[model samples]
Target: MPSLRSIRSRIRSVKNTRQITKAMEMVASAKMRKAQQRVLDTRPYAEKIYELMHRIASREKAWSSPFFETRPVQTIGVLLVSTDRGLCGAINANLFRSLVRFMKERPGVRFEFVTIGRKGRDFIRRSGFNLTGVIQGVKDRGTIEEILPATQLVIEEFSEKKNWQEAWIFYTQFESIMSQKPRHEKLLPIDPEVLTGSGNPPNGHSGEYLYEPDRRDILDVLIPRYFETVIFQRVLENFASEYSARMVAMKNATANAKEVIYGLTLTYNKLRQANITKEISEISSGAEAISQG
Candidate 1:
């Protein structure tokens, strides 16, 4: 048991905490709606561009884009995408765990990382990973200027033959508000099947596709667009995932705060009741004394 004053203070403190959590919950909810819409809207464009690119590649037998060819794995590039801020649930932790596992799986594979956010960059730097490139301050929505540089950096690295065989991007794919799956995808060497929809055994093609121009010429332009579209899609998914995680985190915090308030209210009631009991006892004793006197 504690004094009334102490219990009052505890209740007041919890009240303030509850207010803050409630505000955060509202903000996260609002942001989640916007992010979810953005992810849904951008997906179709990215998919269409990829499909067109595949159709072109599938039509050409001798397309010689560096992006289409595979090479020996001398060096690996890891592009890690994470939120710039914290207060999200286990989003970053899950991404980090997957990253660590990826590293462990390729012990002898020399790797360089391209980090997208401050969180991932800081983590890579602190862990002393060979971080080759970092792009920070990417907006929540997809922006061409913001992503173009990073895409170009990787494309140039491949075109220049920096001894990098493959590039992988790690991101949280937005499945639903309650579910986000950490995904590791090969970004380069654009899977011909992903483009042509042939790689998927279940695609069951209707017929051979038609081409607007020479398939090789179309591929020359489409490969870079493919990279851009993939990056844009990733940015959208990351935003949706961040908002979903934040919303869930704030909701939990709000619930915990409410529980704390309930406990404090119980304690406050008990302390006030004890005070009333003591005061009643004192008054009754005084009345008895007066009567006796």
Candidate 2:
């Protein structure tokens, strides 16, 4: 059994750890709220742009646009969005696992990575993949400008005929406070079928729309803007997921620390009682000896 002093010291240490974890949990909670709100606020615009782009691409003339062109899949450009920091449970782990699974599914296809956070960048480096671009140190409430460089990198790579034939993005989609899932989405070659809801227009709107100036000119601007919006929305989702995961992880840590403190306090009390009992017994023995003497 450990000494009472050592047990007391351990209890104090655990209490301090619990305080830190509790503080982190609170901070994560506040950030999570803001991140979640941002995701919610921007989702409508993202969806509408996606719908509009799909409507345009549904036209036969829209196929002439480079953004609508599909080629044989040989090499793919992958954009991975991850949290900048750690202590967020298995969020990053799940993303990497999904990436590994995706790679396994496409055995012969080559991938060039573009990372949005330090964790993803480090993973690409460790995995010995070709990292084309990196955007790091983005804030919790990051703006589109912060991510524009990586977006442009992906766009430029896809635009070149000799480069990647496909571009995909991997991110954690925020479902709720307790649920976040890693999502793999096609970022380029805009799948009109997928986005247009399988031939059904969104909200039952007839796909008859007149473009201002000309259709080609409108798509030239709309397609890129739509792509950027999608990327930005995904980033916002990742931010929310990061905060949610961190909040839950810290909450669990705080609770576990409390359990440790409780168990240690119980042990300390038991040890101290035993010591007091022993001392009382020793004193009684001495008293009896003196009386007998």
Candidate 3:
């Protein structure tokens, strides 16, 4: 049993913590909404480009682009998108776990990493993996230009055949406010099946289209744009997931702090009542003794 003074101090501390957590929860909620809207706005464009790219690649098999060339598996390039900050529940941990699982699945394969956030960079560095590129301190509402460097790094490495046969991206896909799943997708080799596998296009039609110049010419431009759009969209999805996870984590923290405050208040009241009762008893005993004397 803590003293009344100590219990009062604890209650005050918990109340202060609750206030901070509540404030963080509100901030995260607002950011999450904006991030969600950004993802929603970009998803259609991403899907349409993907469908167009798939259509082109499937039709133009005779075209020879470096992006569609498949080479022997030797070294793999991985772009990991993570949150810059912490307190986002198990989101970062889940991504790391997914990375570990990936490594386990492909044993003895060398992985070159390009990290988009401080957390992923630190993880890659601490794990002693080959970190080829890093892009940190991206804003909450980051632009595509902010991620262009990493995207280019992956593109140049893969296209130039710099020991990178396959390129992949790991990110948290924002399914809903309560659910964010850690996912990875193969970025290079321009797999038309994988592109079309992600469901129908924005118009809900996957029919063939007429290219203006030629299929090869369109692919030469569309392939790179498709890569950039996919990477940018993954970053946006990661942003939404980060905010959603943070908002939920802060909400839980705020609730736990409130519970602590409530418990501490109850203890404080009990101790104060006990102290008052003891003091009254002592006063009555002293008065009785003085009267007898």
lDDT against the true structure, per candidate, is 0.81, 0.88, 0.86
| Tens-digit per-residue lDDT, 208-287, candidate 3 | 66778986787778777888888999999999999999999999999999888888777778888888999999999999
Judge candidate 3 at residue 214 and give its lDDT: 82
Query: How would you encode candidate 2's per-residue C-alpha lDDT over 147-214 as one tens digit per residue?
Result: 88877888889985548888999999999999999998887877777755555655565545776888
Model 3, C-alpha of 18: deviation from truth (Å): 1.1
Candidate 3 structure, TM-score to reference: 0.92
Which of the predicted structures, 1 or 3, would earn the higher TM-score when compared with the native? Answer: 3
TM-score of each candidate structure, all chains considered together = 0.88, 0.93, 0.92
TM-score of 1: 0.88
Give the higher-lDDT candidate: 1 or 3.
3
Query: On residues 1-293, what C-alpha lDDT tens digit does candidate 1 reach at each position?
Result: 57778878888887898788789878878988998998898899887876665554555536566776667777888889888999889988899999899889987888889989888999899999998899977997557678887898788776785657888889989999898888887776655665434454425654545657875676678777888878878877988999888888888888998899898888888778888998999999999999999
Alpha-carbon shift of residue 227 in model 3 (angstroms): 1.7
